[model samples]
Target chain A: MYTMKWIQQDLQQYVQAKAYVDTIIVPLIPFHFSDDASLEKDAFQREVLSVFMRELEKEFSGRILLSPDYHYLKSADKAEEVKRVRSWVEDSWAQPFHHIFFMTVDSSWKKFEQDMNGTLIWLPQIVTESMQFSERQSVVHSQVQQVGEFIRSYWEDDK
Target chain B: MSEDKRPVSRRQFLNYTLTGVGGFMAAGLMVSPLRMAIDPVLQKEAADGDLTNVQLAEGDITNEPQRIDWEIDQVDGWYESKVSKTAWVYKDDNGDIVALSPICKHLGCVVSWEGSEDYPDQFYCPCHDGRYYKDGMNVPGTPPTAGLDIYEHKIKNGMLFLGKAQPREEA
Candidate 1:
């Protein structure tokens, strides 16, 4: 369902399912190329965020529109980005999406989280190199479980 | 040719040649089945569907439908991905275990158990307010024109092995 494009045919059905589920998730990511050293870590965190979003989407599909990854420079200003994010959420084509979540690994979003219209969920970067499969699964599962809980809470509040 | 320097009898030559041809044909016929029996060790299965183990004990299942999630390796064309499959599993009144697919037949929205307050003890799709009875039969006049699908399932060592969900005719 997280294919790169939501084509015309998908758009028609999205219109119909709009009444049932009114939420879209935008995974906010920071892309950095300031240096060879820090960019690697940023890339790693982005990959972890990708895994997290896919896991969450699989658990609650169709109900959760996994929007395209929102990428910005690591050094970009957060206060300015908040308005862009608000406009993106507002541009839902009048389809009545209630909740907009901004999923990120960058803790910078934490400082300005209140200013943004979307829910900013800043996750800790998962150390991917040394972990075994079972450990990784446990880590990812525990984190996604929390995300699911948050979604449920938001659903209740929305009602 | 090695030993029959003496003029061969017509019967002797005919008998020897026929025996050799018959032996060759007999050996040719046995080769295919022998190779088939050993082929499993030589090649991998490409078309076999995956069966995921939904780690639910046989005793845990009851008349009340329980939703269980499990992951399986899925092959779609050239891409291999881990797909999460969910089923509403429970034992029916007859004591037979049933696993039903939770997808609403109308437009593939995920249906929830008793999602609507008014539709007591029924599967409800928030989309179009589709409803299904406890038995996975779609209620008429709902947007869904067909019943929820049933997954092919088997119990192995007390664990549930689930296969593809096959759609049944509308109630």
Candidate 2:
């Protein structure tokens, strides 16, 4: 159940074991530096999404490759972002990933979800910034469990 | 200066040379053993000897397996961060505390207690429908090739401290 570490040795093993590792999870992060008001919200979402992805990776480390985060400007056009995300999918396809999922907390991505090449999973915004660590953890844990089940459902369809 | 530089006696010269070489040999012999004796004291483990306080009260553990979550400081190469960990904890028939790693042996998926409705008393992995008995033993003919890992645990004053999870031999 060892996940792929971003190192040469782990990657060499990944290439050797390509049949076992076929799924990829990409986190879509949005940054808004132009407006000070939206900065905190964007930052909060980024943090929450990363935690969610980490938990997901732990759940299915052997079969899934956690790709680097994909960052974009919040003010960027949805059409333009779709093109950029599709480019990423094309590059990822070179590695023979059968399943590619893009996880995001921004609701705006839902409008252009179908235009993207991979599946877009938009999680609801969680306002747990002020909550205690334990409280927020439980919240994230429950959501991550549901998301994991959802991903498994897709894999089941293939079989 | 000339008087002091008078021809050295062979006996004095040999005595000085022998003392210096003997001192060098003794130091070389002692250095290796000294470093070996102090090596453990200089090394610090990422998990502080692999035991982290899980913050669960001893009384809280019951016969039914309960999920426990805890955080530890992990150092990965040059990066340091807090990593969250989870375990399935319960008391066995003999009233002994048992902690098992929830990672499924098949494909690294997380297993849950009674996850599938059909398997009410066993740990189930939703990824490939893998099942394990209550004691963390994988059901025969399942996808998992090995049994679940057991964690080293210690009870201190009412709190439970857990160490690394050691893999179990297949039954």
Candidate 3:
């Protein structure tokens, strides 16, 4: 239920009720289906990441905001990309949000984890063809549940 | 001419009749297994519409909105997955139990109890900042075009059972 989209009326209500929303989640997605062999796998990974993020939002609705996805080029330099990512985090933090979670399947973010101000949750990129639907559901359900628990602890720690 | 007179014996006639009856009896016996295999698919659709127990006691319901999280087994095509569902439950002034779907009507984002700063007693959405009143009604100037949905509920043996939430009538 976490989304950045709202009509004019909803935005007005959000502005007035800013204090109640305390956390914001931003997903960084890298679009890198340049090669033919990896295109399908990459696309599958993207879909999985999307579902996982939605699950997280559903788990902690009202407490967190699901902002627009952060799309970046696969060929881009990770070092330079950190600045752009930091900017997005800063912009979202301007609100009274006490927690900002960066959800990503990109391995590049691993290096920038310490540099970034927010918490970086880097999920291992999955090979979609290797797993069946039922297996994937179980794998996703368990891992996503753990991630939810981790983020929950942060909120709990605050209290 | 010879073939026409081949089954004239009484014993031969009885054998033919016995074989014919056996085939029909075997098919009749198969009907029970066939029904057993297919009945669940037909009956499941109707039986699942019944309410799910939320494990809350009648005395536990208070005026303040309390979030309840539970999972339900959902069958989609070939896979059976447990989908998590959430609801906000509380008691109104008249002491009636009230349950509302936390999803925002504006754009399907999850709404929260007292999530907004301005609306202290209202359900607020962080996505577009939608708001709903305490009675699950959409605020006049809020983003939600309709009131929040109320869940079908009943109390059995002091326990609350909740079904799907239906759209409330708008005035």
Note the Cα lDDT for every prediction shown. Answer: 0.78, 0.85, 0.78
User: What is the per-candidate TM-score for chain B?
Assistant: 0.75, 0.75, 0.70
- Per-residue alpha-carbon lDDT of candidate 1 for residues A81-156, written as tens digits (9 for 90 to 100): 8888878877863657888788888898898888787788888777575788678767987898788778767876
CAPRI tier for the interface of model 3: incorrect
Worst 10 residues of 1 chain A by lDDT: A1-10
Model 3 off-target regions past 4 Å?
Answer: A1-13, B1-163, B166-171
Two-chain DockQ for each candidate model:
0.20, 0.42, 0.12
lDDT of 2 by residue, A17-112 (tens): 677778888899999779987788778878988877877888877678888888998889989989989998999888788889999988999988
Specify the CAPRI tier of model 2: acceptable
Winning candidate number (TM-score)? 2
lDDT of 2 by residue, B23-120 (tens): 99999999999998977776544444578889999999999999998888889999998877889999999989999999988777789999888899
Predicted structure with the largest lDDT when compared to the true one: 2
Model 2 chain A weakest lDDT span, ten residues long = A1-10
Candidate 2 residues lying further than 4 Å off, grouped into runs, are A5-10, A91-96, B1-50, B75-80, B169-171
List the pairs of residues colliding in candidate 1: none
Better of 1 and 3 by DockQ: 1
What's model 2's lDDT at B133? 96
Restricting to chain A, the TM-score for each candidate equals 0.87, 0.92, 0.86
What's the distance in Å from true for residue B80, model 3? 19
